[model samples]
Target: MDTRRPTIADVAKRAGVSKGLVSFVFNDKPGVAAPTRVRILAAAEELGWQPDPVARSLSTQRAAALGLVVRRDPTVLAADPFFPAFMAGVETALTERRQVLVLSLVPDAAAETATYRSLAAHRRVDGVLLTDLRHDDDRFPLLAELGLPAVCVGRPDVAGAFPVVNLDDAAGLRSAVDHLVGLGHRRIAYVGGDVGMLHGRRRRKSFLEALARHGLDPVGVVDTDFSAAAGARAVVELLAGAVLPTALVFASDPMAVAGLAVLQRQGVQVPRDCSVTGFDGMDLGRHLHPALTTVEADPLAWGRAAATVLLRLLDDGRADDLELPSAALVLRSSTAPPPDPPG
Candidate 1:
């Protein structure tokens, strides 16, 4: 049996290119022609040659990893259904490139900034995936100062040079609102996440616009922390009001699910007393007693797209912004026509 590891020299010879050219292609450095790069890669693949991680890192001055820091309570992150699915999507792309994900959850902005600075200063990650963007996000400037590459999961109204992977939050809200309006719901309420968040503001703005288009006014609007517990609280506040709305639109499935439990406990029959709709069509929504009516925005796809963009930026020093699938309304048993008014 012949057993010998293939070397770069062997690959270069087979590809009819110099060893320097092979190295350039493997390192993903600029100045390599497209055809030559393809030939070099094919030759390396044909020889079953995989770059040694340690050697590659040393030569490339890269960490071969990415950073993701969530500015939320660890408990909140653990209970929130979206993070797990989204992280899985990110891992799918990272696995393909043999990259590592350094994930952390912190309590406040100071901690989040510190985490980013530490990662960049220590050369622990090649890039980062920024999530939960705020209206006046400071991370963009910080990242620029750190000279670390990044991709935002949400589009910021403020301009920045970094690529973004964003979904159509406005369109999704419009669809959700339209669905409720179509179901003979005249007085619709909106339960949204923190208004400080970029997407939260966007969703609320869209909701108001949607209501205007239908010549209706919002019965109520409540903002919460995007947690199940917070959702329950919001529902309680709405229920305690002078007049109850015919329908409620929640910003997240978690909140909607929690609100459902609240309604049931309060003896309010879903879709009879009031129709409920949620954003973020997580699998958990389907398993509910009455499947949730929701705006289906795939968090998994969002994560994958964000990771892909960051990876591209890391490799080539440039990447175009990506727009993932627009949000679609998923009709389920949670919503129905408003009950006939009592004469």
Candidate 2:
């Protein structure tokens, strides 16, 4: 009976599979058959064989960990359902690789950049996943100069030389607009996240384009910090506007949920007095009083997909741009036709 740390070759021999197969399964790479993956895992467990992450990193001259720096207010991160769900998906991928996820929550862009630089200088991670992209993101060139490989969650205006994981959300945005228009919502208002953020701008653009496609004009637009409080405040402002919009589309589920609560407090009958729509397809939305109507974007899938690309880049030195599953619109009781006009 050998009483020593097992190596990749040992696992391969025990599993009766090639070393490459074992590597693929451990790294959660595609193209490995399900049965083979199961067999490999079973063999490794039976032999008490666990890959040493530190040893592997030392030998490979790589950190064997991934970094994610979120430039968000801590309150928003706690309130928003997307970040948690997305991180769960990232964990699922990291679990197989026995890798670590180094997450940093910063208040602003300055702190965020410092965090990235620190991570790179400390050799704390092999690559990073950049989220909450900003217009003319400084992280792109900074990361490139640091020699740190990265994958952007949203398509930056200028990718320079990095692989991006872009979700086709245009269809979902269009569907949302079309849904509102069908409900006799001629005056549609948009509540977006920080216009400076790449996703925020992209979604806002999509919302406007969707309206144009249906031959409707935007009645109002408000930008928020993607916080519940911000959402509530924006809702109040929209409701107080000269020409009240019958439908309000929010950029994220948390904001939408906040807006719904505000509407309820203000004696606004949802889908009766005014209708609301949210994005991010959070499960919490389904349990809301009226079951929120929203565009469904799977954060978990986004996380897993982004992690997959980052891992591939680490392994192969280079990876191609990946198009993730498209977002779609979900209909619920939150949206309805406007009330009849006075005769």
TM-score of each: 0.86, 0.82
Pull out the clashing pairs in model 1: none
TM-score, candidate number 2: 0.82
- Model 2's C-alpha root-mean-square deviation from the true structure amounts to 7.4
Clashes of 2: 0
| Per-structure clash totals for the candidates | 0, 0
Give the lDDT of residue 16 in candidate 2: 90
What is the clash tally of candidate 1?
0
Q: For model 2, which pairs clash? A: none
TM-score of 1: 0.86
Candidate 2 deviant stretches above 4 angstroms: 1-56
Model 1: how far residue 279 lies from native, Å:
1.1
Per-residue error for 154 in candidate 2, Å, reads: 1.3
lDDT of 2 by residue, 75-133 (tens): 77898878898899888999899998999999977898789889999999999998887
Q: What is the C-alpha lDDT of each candidate?
A: 0.90, 0.88
lDDT of 1: 0.90
